[model samples]
Target: MRRKVRNYILIVISMVTGTVSFAQTEIENPFGLVYRDAITENLPGKVNIQPVTYTLNGIEIAANVYTPANYDPDKKFPAIVVAHPNGGVKEQVAGLYAQLLAEQGYISITADAAYQGASGGTPRNVDIPHNRIEDIHGMADFIIQYEGVDSERIGLLGICGGGGYSLKAAQSDKRFRAVATLSMFNSGVVRRNGFRNSQVNTIQERLKKASDARAQEAAGGEVIYAADNAIPTEEAELAKIPYDLYREGYIYYGNTHKHPNSTFRYTMSSLLYLMTFDASTNMNLINQPLLMMAGSKADTYYMTDEAYRKVTNAKDKELFLIESATHIQTYYVPEYVSQAMEKLNVFFGKYINSEA
Candidate 1:
C-alpha cells in the first residue's frame, strides 16, 4: 500500500518536471500577486502575532499566536487554535484567519503541522493519517498551558485539511467547546481521487503506479512532488478555479505570506498517507458545537454539507454560506474574512463569552 502511494507521488513530481505533462495549459489566477484590499486595512487591533514553540508528542512544534490588541492578560481570555491545510504551513490562509479572529479578542494560534514548516520532523510531509489528528490535540494542549488562556473556553478553527482534523478532534476529545472549518477538504478523499473525484476512474492504473513507485524508491531515486495548480490547458472551468487557488496559495505562503521557513508543499510520502486517509469515515461521531462555513462557489462545498448532515451528536451546528466568495477569496479577502469573523465571534461568544 505504501509503495502504491509513493508511485502516485512520482506522477506529481513528473508533472512538475514536464516529463509527463497532464495538461499543457497555464491558467492565470484572478487574485494574482496584488490584492487591493489587504488585511492591514481591517486589522485595527494591536495585533501581536509572534512565533513560539511547544512540545507535542515529544516533538518541539513551531507556531504563531495572534493576540488581539484588545487582549488583557489580567482577564484570562478564550483562545482559538487554528490548523493549516495539508501540504501547507502556519502562514497560509490559516494564519490570516487566525489573525483576524484574534482581532475579535480571541487568542488564535496557527501552527506548522508535524513534518512541515519550521517544526522538527523527519520524512517531511509524509502525511501519516494519525499524526495530523494528533497535531490538532497538540495545539489544543499548547493553548491550555498558556498562562493567560481560558482553557475551558478554547475553540478550534481549521482550514482545508486542518478543518478535517478539527472535526476529528471535537469528536474524540471533549476539550474543545466549539469547532469550525473553512473550505474544508476531506484530505483523504481528495488524495485517493482528485478534484471532484476526477482521477478515480481506474484502479488498475493506480495499482501500477504503486508498484512502480516501490521499485523507484528501492533504486534511491529522489522523490518528486506536484507543483501547485498546474491544471491542463483543457481542464473544465471549475477545475481552473482550484488551479488558480493553488497559484495564489503559492504566492501567499511562498512569498507575501509571513512567517519564515514555511512552505506551500510537503514531502512526496505525504501522498501515500493522503491516498488512504478519510476524515469523513466517522462523521456521525463528532458531537460538539460545530460551525461549518464555506463559499457558496467553492469546489469543496459538498464536503461541508455532507459533514454537517452526518454529525449525529452535535449539540449545536450551523452551516454558513458566504455569497460571491469562492474558496480562494475567503482566504485573503477582508470583506469575506470580516463576515467570517463576525459569524465566528457570535458562535464562540455563545459558548466562550456567555460563560464569563
Candidate 2:
C-alpha cells in the first residue's frame, strides 16, 4: 500500500512538470512597428508627408516621407531614404536624421524592419539576411514612385546595423547614388565574433548554445529572447572592452536613454543565422560612392574597417574616425550628430551635384 501511494504521488508530479515545460506564453508585438514623430518637439510647420504603406517580398512594410515644412509641389527636390539601427524605430535617431535633411530642402523617409517595432512578420526580429537586404530595395522602390523628385539623386544613410544593410543593398541595387553609415555595426561579424571580435575564441561554445536553443525551441519550450549579456566584472584588467561596454554603458543607456521602452531584447538563437552572414562576399563589386564612419573609440571600428577594405569598385570611398566618441554617443548627441550630418551633406552633395 505504501509503495502504491508513493508511485501515485510521483505520477502527479511528473504530469505537472511536463505541462509546465510545454506551456506556451503568448508574446504580443506592442510597438506595432510603425514609428511617427515630429522633427521638433515644438513640431515643424506645414510638412505634408504622405504616410504610405508598401509590401516587400509579400511582407507589409510601413514608412513616412518627410518634406520641408514649406514644401512646394511644383518644385522638384532630391531625396534620401534612411535605415535605422537594429531594434530601433523611425521615431529614434534615424527619423531625426531624415527629418533634419528634409528640413534642409530635401525629401526623406524612414522605415521599420519586419516583425520589430511596427513592421510585419511572424517570428519577430529573426534577422534573415535576405529580408534585411530586400528591405532597402523595397525602400528604393517607394522613393522612385514619389512625384516631383529627381529619381537619380536619391541617397541612403544607415545607422548601426542599418548601415551594414545599406551597404549590402548598394552592392547590387543601383538606386542609391551615395551611401553613408553613422557608427555602423556589421551585424554578421558582431553576431559571430562579438562587437570587436571578442567572441572569436568562443565560436564553438556559442555554436553549442545556439544548437541547444534550437532543440529547446523545436521541443515544447517557449521561444526565448536573450541579448548578449556580457558584463565586465572586477576583473576588467583581463576583460575585453566590448564586454565592459555592455557591462557598464549599454546597461545605463539601454535602461534609461529612450525611456519607457528602454529595456528591449532579441532572440539568442539569431546567432545561427548571423554567424553565417558575410556582407563583404560581393562587397567589392559595388561601383558607387561610400562613406564609412565610426567612433575612434567605438568597439565596432573593426566592422567598418573590414567593410572599407573589401570594396574595390567604389568610385570614391572614405572612412572617418570621430575622436573620443563611443558607439552609442552618435545616436542623439548634438556634437556627434552635427558632425555626422555635415559629412552626410557633403557626401551626398558631391555625388548628386556631379549630375548637374
**Number of clashes in every candidate structure?**
2, 5
Clashes of 2: 5
lDDT by residue for model 1 (87-140), tens:
666655776677777767888887887777778786555566688889888988
Model 1: residues >4 Å from true position, as ranges? 1-45, 202-204, 207-264
TM-score of each: 0.78, 0.78
- Misplaced by over 4 Å in model 2 are 1-50, 212-221, 228-256, 259-264, 353-355
TM-score for predicted model 2 compared with the true structure: 0.78
What do the candidate models score in CA lDDT, each in turn? 0.69, 0.68
